[model samples]
Target: MNLFADMRAVVISALDQMVADGALPEGLDFANVAVEPPRDAAHGDMATNAAMVLAKPAKLKPRDIADALASKLMDDARVALADVAGPGFLNLRLETGVWAGVVQAALEQGSGFGRSDMGAGRKVNVEYVSANPTGPLHVGHTRGAVFGDALASLLDYAGYDVTREYYINDGGAQVDVLARSVYLRYLEAHGQEVAFEDGTYPGDYLVAVGEALKDKVGDAYVDTGEQVWLEEVRDFSTDAMMDLIRADLAALGVEMDVFYSEKSLYGTGQIEAAIADLKGKDLIYRGTLEPPKGKVPEDWEPREQMLFRSTAHGDDVDRPIQKSDGAWTYFAPDIAYHYDKISRGFDELIDVFGADHGGYVKRMKAAVSALSDGRVPVDIKLTQLVRLFKDCAPFKMSKRAGTFVTLRDVVDLVGSDVTRFVMLTRKQDAPLDFDFTKVLEQSKDNPVFYVQYAHARVCSVLRKAQAEGWDMSDAALAQVDVSGNTHEAELKLAAKLAEWPRLVEIAARTNEPHRIAFYLYELAGELHALWNRGNELPELRFMQDTAEASAPKIALARATAIVISAGLGILGVAPAEEMR
Candidate 1:
């Protein structure tokens, strides 16, 4: 079903024949040889750098090898013309039936059209949106949530056993502050006014948690000290915050396979076990770190501490695992978390972090590398900030969150589909501007609308055809002969359809789901181009004077819609059936 792969196989078979016939040397490595679309459509349908890459390795001139490969490739039924271009590159023009076959494949495969087996069913863990369980998730976490969710879906489509995970940051000083804040609200629930200090959370979102705590325990801990209720209230506050976080994620249609707690690593001998493994490998040692590079601050005194030889793995410096106070450093728990993941037998690991956590990447990778003895690879993707705008002005609409906009605020404003789609409209490492004005517009400038409109257009055609009493099921449309869909616009769309499988593999290989969004936009543009062309050329319209003449056109449109649905599914966006 993958036309590009099929053609690449054809090219490889022809090259193998060339070698067998003594036209080429015996032991040439074709690993670097690639068959891809040409830079310009006017040149040809596809281009290969087989001759260019092999020229020096084969000890032969580029032109000579290209000329030999061209004649050999022309023998294939799929290659209509194999022209040796310039010095070495070979340009190939495929038969028209090849593009037609791609459209037919789309109709037959439905949403499974672009699914790939590149990962070979390897297990992968993708951890994202691990926001601290102190309050509601903000806009920054929303971007990470959408990015990680889409990436998991993309990996699943690419044949990986993906586990969507969220690491709950509850075992930290922040949750203690949350507990104290909730206690303040608990006092308020008892009809006593309380003031929130600088270190305590003052968000209105915690008021409900306070009221619920009062309902659970009455006024029993009203006059108690920190030791009397700190542990009990900390546990209560964290669970409440997690419940809120889960609801926010569900609002955006995101669900995780695992909600791992950081506190679980403590008091379970896990941290000591992880460090002990590193110690056994001779990676742990007691050492003093160097001082700050530039001007030394007041607290810049160096001290001997327990350290990990992170530099040996790839980090810039060896990292400290324990403080001078003998307590575990923040990095220790993270190391244990990843160690637990490694012991779970995942083939690979992926962490979706925020832009602010960029400094932690190298050390975390080094930890996984050291823990797994370099057998497991970890890819860390950092999502940048998202700036919101409304009416051409900066928008801040979160009174409940007190300081920042919450994920529910954004989702409630536009919708889950628009929120998810707009979040992925940019690269993970690039800053995104989520303008409410532009995203909600019902125009081509809005990518969410434009792509959905294309699907809706196809749905409208299906409805009209069905009302006319003509059978328009996918089985019927797939049976139509689309070889006569030779119009340049129609063929252009089919060519774009042929790139879906290749694009899916590329996006999954690079761990970039934004590529899917970009590809879907381009594919929608092609379909829209064909739809607009039908306005001027009556023959290009889907509804012809007779069902016999219209079947092929309708089949092509339905095929486009099917691929659109598949791409949107990866992005966690519902394909619109009708424009509203």
Candidate 2:
């Protein structure tokens, strides 16, 4: 099904035959030998470095090896022409029948055409959008949510057992701040005047939580001290905020398999257990710390503290695990969380964080490395900021969120499909400018619209064929003789379809789902180009003089739609049957 892989095998088989016939030496490692598309399409359909890589190792001239290999390759039915390019690289032109087979495979497989088994079922835990449960998710978290969810889907398609997770930052000073803020709202609900001071939240979203608290407890905790209501309200308010966050994520089509609470690590001996495991390895120590590189503070002095020898595992410096007063530091709980994940027997781990957390990546990876003793691998991806523009100017912040635009604000304005697709239009590590006016524009300049329009066009073609009383189902179109689809545009589109499986494997291997977005856009361009060509040449049209004659052209259009739907599915965007 993967023509690139199939051709690579053919090349390797020919080289083995060369070794047997004494044209090449025995025991040359073919691991680095690669077969890929030629850099310039004018050169040929495929190119291989088999001759170049083997020349030096085989103690033979590059040109001499290439000549012999070309002769052996021409014997195969798939290779129509094989010739040496430059010094020794072999460029190949596959038979036209090869493209026909690719089109048939796409029709036969439908959306499953590019699914790969490269992961071999390894368990991968993907933790993303672990924003503190202080309020509804904002635009920054939305990018992380979309990126993480799409990555989980891509890994699943590549055969990894992926679990989507969210780590709640509840056991922190931030939650206490949220409780006090909600208490002010609660007092307001009781008809009492209260001011949201500098340290409290003033967002209008918490107004309902305050009113709901009044209904639950009546006047029980009215005018009570912090000792009486802080704990109870903290739990109550955290639950409410999480409900809001969950609803926000649901609006964007993101669902987590697990919502891990940081509070559970405390009073549970988990932090101590993680540290104990490190202690057993002599990585924990009581040592003096050095001053920071810049101008030292006037109150600064060298002090001994409990630290983890993080540098032993790849961190820049030894990190403190506990304060001088013996309370656990912020990094301790994170280490414990990852230790718990390692104990859960996951084979790999991935973390999706906002760009501001770039400095935190090294230490987190070091913690997992030290915890798993290099038995498992962890990759951390950081999503950069999103700048929103509306009406050709900077968009205003949401009054409901108080300081920033919430996830629902973006989704409500442009819809979940547009929001999701546009968020991934740029790389996670690169900043993205999302223009409201431009994204919704019905033109080729808009990537999401371009891709969706291609799918809709295919649907339109199928409908027209069906109304003409032709059988246009996948089973029937798959059986069509597509050898007659020899037009330059038709063959070019089919060649692009042949790249899907290879592209999926590359994107999955690099943990970059944005590549999928880029590929979908390019694939859509091919379909659009071919569709436009049909207008110039009547013979290139999908609907021909007869139904039987129209079968091949319709089959090509249907195959393009199948691949688009599959790519969009991975991105969590529903394909459009018809665009308004």
Candidate 3:
């Protein structure tokens, strides 16, 4: 159960009583009224702005409303103290029984302690790592992959019907270049020396694709023209590249429920159908174009083109769906792709694009809005660049990816766990620096290691307890009475655990999964701090002179581990039972 939500309900009940007694006006909106942790712990356990928010609206004074509300709340046994602060902010200190119940709740709930029903089973499509199927996914794609996968997992934890998806960019001219690159490698595999031109992919990863192509075709397309082999080789090369991409993603703990093909939209009339749908809404138009702002193109000229009226939905300018040459622009396929998602009955769509795609966000949102007639909401999250560091210097590029560090290289160096956790330590829109120097360190400086260490410490406590012939299972710990264990050290940790359910809803609502990583780190810190306190205070320890007496203390430790495991599960990271 959410302690904050429960307290908010108590505050709302008090306000309703005031309205009933004619002390406050009726029909005041409580939607903006919030009950949350007090800014200063010294103030109280929780605070609410119910009085201040309703004072002006109710035509009443702040102090008068706050006093009446506080008096009404004092009748509840759960509320130990309720007093008005500076204005009408109600600062409340809950009874110690309330905090103890949180530990009991965590033990009873196990890893599902913080799972929320905030999403209410809404279907959400999360598309990420939609790199061109020409080669391996690189470091930039790795960040997007981790962010998107973790976000999908987070939303699922918050009760969303989430789908992890990847879009393959095989419908564009880039795939033709990949075909030519594989042809050159195919020629090399046949003992004919071939040089990679400036536009060709020369990464060693393609060598195997070329050899496999030669094995299947066996000189059938060796001396053929472009028309005869372009389609076939492009298909072959894209399949192989996707196979490699899947392996790379698998190594990093990423698995997509859907691998959508851009090519599937090309010949299936899906692109035309989506455009036609928009055309029916009067969103499509043929209009003269203006040159872009600042530096204009050298060949800038006014041309009538098919455009989507994106400006109506908040885009800076109308986006062209078709070019002067009559070929569909890159934006056309994305519109069709999102339209297809809407047709599949997804309530929400989230695109996890690299930071370079920031400029496309408004247009994409506009397309989804027009396609769904504003019935659906689309959120585009941009993952910023990850600058890698090793040996106190910037990391070098990968030979496998030719121009960047491949995802496999990072996973191979530190394993998938470190790579994933470090990738999410920062906000998705903020740049992150992944330093081998810092991440691998076994100290509080390394967030992943620090959090894992806290979990491992709890496991060690349980093992010690079990070895002493004391049962430490969740059921046994959950049965213990936590009211007697009242050290500030223990209660502080319990307070942090109480924030979990509230934090989950906040993160899910904001579509930010990094908040989970950050929260886990703070929770781990509180746990570690409590552990440190035990060294100075003998009674504060998990194990005491008597096994039965120490059960309540052990319950607290186990509850902390339960929440840690639940949080790590959401981030797609494994909780370490023991540190290596």
Candidate 4:
């Protein structure tokens, strides 16, 4: 059903015919030959670089190869013309029936229209939103959550077996700090006034956790020192915080298939085993790291420590796995976690991290490479900061002011669909501006609203057609004769619809879910444009005065809706039937 792929096959067959006829040399590699939408739509329906790529390899002139390829290509019923231009680019104008066939295919496939089997069912583990289990997720984690969830869905649509995962950072020193913070809250619950100092969390979110602890064990650690309550309180508080985080993610429509605990890597022999696997390959050693360039820490002193030879695999230098005090460094657990992922037999691994973790990307990749012996590839995507604005001014959140925006706050303001869609409107590696005023605006400038409006518009068309006694069921729509619809605007929409399956494959291959958001915007733009064109041109209108004509035209409009719904489904956004 992919028109471009179909046309590419025709182009390849023609090239093979040329080789047989002695119009071109034998055994020219066609891997670089690509058939894609022409840069200018006015040029043609599709364009191929076959002549240009094979000219030098075949020792033939560009125009000569293009002429021979064009003649052979024109023999296909689908191809109307294959014109050579600019040294060997072959621009093709496909028959109107080809575009109509695309619309018919969309209507026939329904939600499965754009599903691709490019991944061949490879297992992929996507770990994201692994924020420190110290507090409720904030705005920073929101972007990662949305991006990761959408990516998992996108890969699934592209036929990858995806596992959405969250790695809890409970084994770090930050959890101990959370423990002390909850102890203060516990004292407050016992009617004792306590001030939150420099090292403890002061957010009111933990107030309930403190009260719950008191309820569970009344007066047990009333005035005890850190020794008696630290360990127990740490475990209790981390569980509470993780609950809060899980609720926050649920509010944003994110559900993880697994919640991996960092603490689990500590008591088990997992860390030792992971490092031992690397050591067997001579990748682990006691080494001194060079001081970071440009701005060294004031306490800069070289120390020999247990390190991973990350430089052997693409990192800038070997990274420390253990501190001088014979304790595991932060990198140790992460390495062990990835090793665990590799052991789980995933064919590939993807990690979505915040932009601040950019420095850790290389080392993590190195660890996975060493663990899997380069058998599996790890792709780390960094989601940059999201700047919020209100009243056309920058909105700042301050932890000290007790006004920091949580993920719940954003979802509550705009709902999960808007929040998720808006978060993905920008590339993960690029900074995004989430303007409260702009996102909710009903105009076409708002992508979420615009895409939703296209779906809703299609619903309006169906309702109108049904009220007029025109059969508009899925089965009836699939039987419509789209052959009568040949308007340039209508064909343009069908052409855009043809790109959906290709878009899914590209987005999944690049491990980018933002591309789906971008593609949806473009598709919505085409749909809206065609709808607007109908206002000016009577022939382009969907609802005809007669049932026979209306069924065919409205069928195309319904086909647009089908593709939009499929695309939105991949983004995990519910397609709107009507927009308020």
> What tens-digit string does per-residue lDDT give for candidate 1 at 1-580?
7788888888888889988998778899888888888999888888999999988978889999999989988888888999987998899998999888998899888888989999999999999999999999999999999999999999999999999999998878888999999999999999998998978888999889999999999999988899999999999999999999999999999999999999999999999999999999999999999987788899788899999999999999999999999999999999999999999999999999999989999999999999999999999999999988997798777557888889998999899999999999999999999999999999889999999999999999999999999998999989999999999999888998999998899899999999999988999999889889999999999999888899999999999999899999999999999998
lDDT of each: 0.93, 0.93, 0.91, 0.89
Give lDDT for model 2: 0.93
TM-score of each: 0.98, 0.98, 0.98, 0.97
Candidate 4 ranges with C-alpha deviation above 4 Å:
397-403
Q: Per-residue CA lDDT of candidate 2, range 1-580, in tens?
A: 8899999999999999999998888989999888888998788888999988888889899899999999999999999999897799899998889999999999999988999999999999999999999999999899999999999999999999999999999999999999999999998999999998978998999999999999999878887899999999999999999999999999999999999999999999999999999999999999988898899999998888999999999999899999898899999999999999999989999999999998899898888989999999999999999998986788775557887789999999899999999999999999988899888999999999999999999999999998999999999999999999988889888988998998898899999999999999989999999989999988998889899989999999999999999999999999999999
lDDT of 4 by residue, 355-449 (tens): 99999999998889889989999999999998999867997755521546788888888899999999999899999999999999999889999
RMSD to truth, every model: 1.1, 1.4, 1.1, 1.5
Residue-level error in angstroms, candidate 1, position 483: 0.4
CA lDDT, candidate 4, residue 27: 73
TM-score of 4: 0.97
Q: How does candidate 1 fare on TM-score?
A: 0.98
